[model samples]
Target: MFDHVVFGVSDYAASKAFFLKALEPLGVMLVSEGPLGIELCRPDSQSSLCIRRVEAKATHLHLAFTAESRGQVEAFYRAALEAGGEDNGAPGLRPQYHANYYAAFVIGPDGHNIEAVCHQAEG
Candidate 1:
């Protein structure tokens, strides 16, 4: 539905490091870097996630990435915490969204709500 998403951050280096570690479990990696910021993408996807340095402080934004399974959601939460993310919501079934909506949420360095969700039923 989207080609890419860009996040404007106040501290480029810190946010970049946070994302690099946080998104690793999802198989997203740094694809390119520049003086202003860096870009990240999954191995097989054309869509990218870019974080740019801006003079102003970044506003809160909610971004969710798809997870292949519940286990991946759990991994994302763990990685996010280890990478300096604050816990917003722990990994669990969000039955309010749907029966199979398993997800985890974390507050990113720029205070954005980052999430990883899996929409598959548990066997």
Candidate 2:
């Protein structure tokens, strides 16, 4: 539905590090970095998420990324916690959303809700 999204953060370095670790499990990596911002992209090289340094306080936003499998969702949660993210929701199947809606959520360094979701049915 969207091409890309940018998040404004107060502490660029910290937010960058947090995202780098958290998104690693999803195969998202740093595509570009500059004084003002850093961009992360999937293996396809399409920039999907970006974090920009801002003078104003960062605003909280809910962002969700698609995961290829349930294991990736779990890995994202573990990586996010290891990178200093606060737990919002543990990895599990959200039957309320759908039968195969497995997901995990965390609050990032900038206080934004970050999520990884897998829609595939259990094998």
Candidate topping TM-score: 1
Write the residue-wise lDDT of candidate 2 on 6-115 in tens digits.
87999888898999999999999988888769889897855479889998889779999999999999999999999999999999999999999999999998899999
lDDT of 1 at 14: 80
Residue-pair clashes per prediction, in order, are 0, 0
Write down the lDDT of every candidate, Cα atoms only: 0.92, 0.92
Candidate 2 weakest ten by summed lDDT? 43-52
Error of 1 at 38 (Å): 0.8
TM for every model, in the order presented, reads: 0.97, 0.95
Q: Which ten residues in a row have the lowest lDDT in candidate 1?
A: 10-19
Q: Candidate 2: TM-score?
A: 0.95
Error of 1 at 113 (Å): 0.5
Give the Å shift of residue 55 in candidate 2: 1.6
